[model samples]
Target: MWTVAGEIMGLWSRDIPEPNEVTFTTMIGALAQTDQFKEALELFRLMLRKRVPVDSVSLSSILGVCAKGERDIGLCHGLSCNAQGKQIHTMSIKLGFDRDLHLSNSLLDMYAKIGDMDSAEMVFVNLNQHSNVSWNIMIAGYGNRCNSEKAAEYLHRMQCDGYEPDDVTYINMLTACVKSGDVRIGRLIFDCMPSPNLASWNAILSVYNQIADHREAIELFRKMQFQCQHPDRTTLAIILSSCAELRLLEVGKEVHAAAQKFGFYDDVYVASSLINMYSKCGKMELCEHVFSKLPELDIVCWNSMLTGFSINALEQDALSLFKQMRSLGFFPSEFSFATIVSSCAKISSLFQGQLFHAQIIKDGFLDDIFVGSSLIEMYCKCGHVHGARCFFDLMPGKNTVTWNEMIHGYAQNGDGRSALCLYSDMISYGEKPDDITFVAVLTACSHSSLVDEGLEIFNAMLPKFGVVPKLDHYTSIIDCLSRAGRFHEVEVFLDTMPCKDDAVVWEVVLSSCRIHANVTLAKRAAEELYRLDPQNSASYVLLANTYSSLGRWDDARVVRDMMSDKKVLKYPGYSRSVCKNDTQMILENKQ
Candidate 1:
């Protein structure tokens, strides 16, 4: 009642007069109710500064806010919520609520949300009372911290203490499995559950989705139907995400039909997932149709629709929507700007990219690290590699992707020296190079013919940074040796690769053979490439071009006829000024 009266009084009261203990707590409640969590916290601090008596009621509401804001809270925005949680704990003790179990539980939860399992355990230890909720919080805390082993340890302890596992307990344990990406352990826990509920199944399915085990996610959804557990909106969302990523259009359409039948399409999250799925599958028409059907749209929905257009190479459509989005009185999110900037990069539109760059600055998202990275990429894609480097240097921070983009830009612009130097600096600055970084630097080495440096970097990747080379690495080295006309080195390197039949590397070798007019090697590479990736037109074109260079018209005609038989349309030609890396492959035999 006091809290209620304080809320009404607060709206009308001028000068915001200070209140007694009851009214101070009331004002805290009123602030919290209005979602003015920061203000509520400020009032709590004022209560302490003015020496007002504090109690559990005010502590409970404020603690809940701090707990939920753990990820979101930052020192720059205010006192770190985690730091504030500790401060509030000190206040709780001063006010004689230290022994209050309910307040202590809230404290334990706050620590857990911050992934401070040790502090949570300390609270759990000193508490004179324990409940299943307390145990569950601890287990869930470890899971949130990705310390699945510790979560399992607590599960064993909880069961030994005669607190038999309930549905919630099992859910937390499975959540640990999900965090660890251990399908086996999650399956074991699910099988032992006395009765698994919908959330429990969703949790496991979500794990599969997170790990990109899309096939398992699809199978599990089918099993859910067989077991007669009605899949809810969340279930549909997760399954649709899997379908979108895997490009399983048929499965996604079936789920879409089911969503309409069950009315889950009414849910914004479900509808958004469907929009994303359709765009990923290259069905922009469906993406637009589903988006237009929404009763209302939020910023997230707008971002999704714009992202769909950008990723599908519909830059013009994305720009149209961007104009429409702002006209609807919705501001673009940082992600929205980043996605549109990426679209500009894709289409290599320098003038348009500059426009978005100005807009990002006007919108005050220039400081967003992702938007900054996109600006670098946009400049690089527009053929201004030096400008890209300038943006990269100006940014306050650089993630691996940003570093890779700069390195790639230098390599593409034929500035191998700068690319290599930037890579060295990336290590000096302690930003770990990932597989993409290796690909970029290796390509840099190939472009500059820095063979020894490239080899050393490639060899050091696994030992120094624990990055394993994928097929792209193999193809890059082949490109390096092939361009340098080192046929012997190429053959030796090919022998060292795990598989000689790697279609991409063979294609690279074939391309090199075509450039060097090494008919014998070209024939060998073409035969192997055709055996491995027969549908690829580049391999046949390379072989036919090599034949034509040697004045073997019949052989060249046979290859062209083969393409015609396979119904493979030959690509149009490129100007000789194109980048040397991909230019050879996309060339035509214009005899």
Candidate 2:
């Protein structure tokens, strides 16, 4: 097809009769559709060279190709200027073609698409009569680039002047609302819809979904259906997202069935969402079935399947699928690498994690914050805390999550001093710590027995930074005091806990009491622990040990007898067998 188009050009220049504007317009349209925009531009240049009079018909055709913004609009603008610069307004000087509205609209659209609003306004203001098509393009230009305030102003003014908005204008406004997160303003626009079409319904639905109001999203879908407006691909996609968030497997299944009902299962977008929904809800078998039915795959489809496998803890499968993507000639995107790095974290295989890390560097995505964060987490979880630190330092930019990862990595590796040092550095550099940062910092203080430091940091959190303490912060404080053997202090603090005691909090106090051999406090902590974790045998066993260590033999025997009656078997202890130089096998008692 390309060769024939090339041959047509060869004949046109040699001996063919002068081609009319329609011929040039038709050929350019075909070339643009075939993605040969450069060749089409060359043909337009040839016409200009031969002194063939160019009309708005030919000008608009070339402008249409620029509308995609794939071509250099600057060069297009230059050509438009050369053809009609200051001397001839092609839209006004049309001779053979009856005032070409389509071409004139395309010219206005090209200027807007390139963000050359000065030229666009010039064209717009010069229009002999305005049409909804041209007006819609200008409104969309503002919205497409996230100029919401300007879009709203222009849209409102356009409406006040008696120009009724079409479906395109409403979609633009709805998109603006979704991004701006003005749900109230979005609702106002929704009510103002003269006649809401399927696209408008889907737009409103997307706004609700983005803000995470799943119930509202679904309710809108139900309303749309009850109004007899059939759901399209976009509607099904939105419904699938709502189902994923709610984890309502039944609703997800219903949506999948609806997709098949409307032959939308073949849509790569909707099908991908279905796979994601099933996988997120923990139905791997159903996810696999949906994934296998997809006829073709884009990056989105591949990412969905890869993420599904990752979420299901199928590490080997996820890696294999990623390799398959490359072997099938699909370029792995940043999301693909991030997903594989996460899988490596779960499997705790440093070799695989490094392999993916090297691939990320090769792809130039190693600097991407998402990929960098994943690499740091993978290295930390795999016992390569130093390697994780190295990557964190090498990252070009760091978000709050990146800083939190480093802090948590230090705490998990028992480098409490280093964690505290990093926290100080983070503050010195003016990076405000979030709640997760406080958790890591407090944990570090707890591990290092720095009670005074922990208290200082905790107190400063609410007053100095306005970050109120969460359950994690409270737990960290309790754990720090207990690890320091301040059992009485822990008990006093527990009495003042604003939130009810959870298993972890009670476990903290109980563990400290057992360490200090405080019989009365141990008994109380045990009761609280048992209330939180009813089936916990360790709580009962620890309480009995507390009694035995205190020389209360009768009370200890009674606790043991109760355990026997309840079939709460105590864990047996065994010593390890080791060779002189190398390791040896030993059969330890099974708890």
Candidate 3:
């Protein structure tokens, strides 16, 4: 079709001495329809250069092309397209076509698609007439920008103006909810639909997935099927993602079969999703099979397989695949670099991590937050806190994760003062700390025996930072007090915890009791741990050791007898090391 259009365009240009308004408008619309946007723009310019009379139809067609072309080229080039659109708008006003309904609507759509909502609103408000297209464009534009409030306001205004909400309006509203993560509002919008279509189902399912409510997404998908709505490629892909998050391999397989049945198995996105689902389920063999069977591979497919290898502890395999990808001239995305860097961190391959860091810098991904965060983690895990700090300081932007990594890195390296100072700086910089930030700071206090400081931070968590203390925060505080031989404070804290029965808290107490030879507290902690984790030998061993250290041989014997009666044997400790070749070796303590 494009070839025929091109041939006809060539003939028209050569054979016609001077093309009139109708001929120019027809050719411009045809070129735009075929996605020949540059040619269409050129023809419009040629018409202007020749001083051909521009009609409302021709101007509208050119505006439509500008809107679509702006979207395709992205914001940088969209600015140029937007300027050209404004120039055309000026021409329309000069020619007395600005009041033309079709041309005014075209102006509204052009401004909206170019992300000039201010101009779009101006065009919309000044128009003497409104159409469904005008309202839908405004709603979709605001929705795309994640301004759900504005989109909802537009919806209300649209109805008040005597225009009934249609399927497209509801879908746009649902999309706004999806972007804003307003799950309840999304559900309300979806439920308000008189009869939702496949696109609507997919949009609502995405809402659930976006919030990590994978179980709800799966249930909604089941309901969708019950309503006799056949799954499309988008549906299968969203459900498969939900399945991956929940590690529901069986459900994922069902979605995979559905994709095949619907003849969407070959679609690049669906195939990539299958690989991701299998990879996340720890089914690397299946992931490999699906990847190998793909007739053609896009960048997404390659990245999925690389992530699968990294997650499955196949760091060497991931590195090999990454090398192969680069060899094949497949440009690595930020995700690809981040994944490989993470694999390097897991295996403690500092040399390989440094190589990848250089590659990331060379590829100009050094500024990407994800890649920068990964580099920080890799350096920290490789026992290079200085290197991590260098990257952290050089980062032009830092999110909560980036700060958390650097603080945790310092905490792990026993630089508690530095970690706490960084946390203070984070606060002063106006970066809102999350739960993970508290955990990192608390852990720093624990390692440095700053029990008072740790407790103060924990107390201020909800009030100052609006961060609710989770189990890890509690664990860190407990560890901090216990390490300082403050058993009374530990007891008081444990009693105040909502999850007092949690075995991890008792384990921390018991370990500290063993260290300080507090036989009574050791007994209490051991009993709780025994009840919570039966057949585990750690609690029994710790209690017996504490008793024996205080010369209570009889009590120690009794505890050993209890362990023997329960038939619980202590497992040997092990240490892991990574070789230069990226192979992991586990050394077990025979003692």
Best by TM-score: 1
Which residue runs does candidate 2 get wrong by more than 4 Å?
1-165, 188-195, 323-331, 361-364, 463-466, 487-498, 518-591
Model 2 quality (TM-score): 0.69
Show where candidate 3 strays beyond 4 Å: 1-54, 58-100, 107-131, 138-165, 188-195, 226-228, 361-364, 390-399, 424-432, 456-464, 498-501, 557-591
In terms of lDDT, the poorest run of 10 residues in model 3 is 582-591
User: By the lDDT metric, which is better: model 2 or model 3?
Assistant: 3
Residue by residue across 231-342, what tens digits does model 2's lDDT show?
Answer: 9988998989999989989988988887898888778999889989998899988987887888887999899989999988787789889989999999989999889899
lDDT of 3 by residue, 1-591 (tens): 454435655787799866799998998999899988777887887788778899999999999989988766543323567888998999999999978988998998898878899999999989899888889889988888888989999999999989998899999899888887778888988998888999999999988888899999999999988998898878988999999999999999988888888888678889889998999999999988888777888899999999999888898899999999999899999999999999988877888899999999999999999999999999998889999998899899999999999999989888889999999999999999899989899999999988888888999999998888888988999999999999998889788888877888898999999999888888889999989998888899999999899899999999999999999999887665445464444333343
Q: Whole-model Cα lDDT per candidate?
A: 0.84, 0.79, 0.88
List the candidate numbers ranked by TM-score, top first: 1, 3, 2
Q: Supply every candidate's count of residue pairs whose N, Cα or C atoms clash at under 3 angstroms.
A: 0, 0, 0
lDDT tens digits by residue: candidate 1, 333-429: 9999999888878767777788899999898998788898888888987788878877778887778988888999888878888999999999999
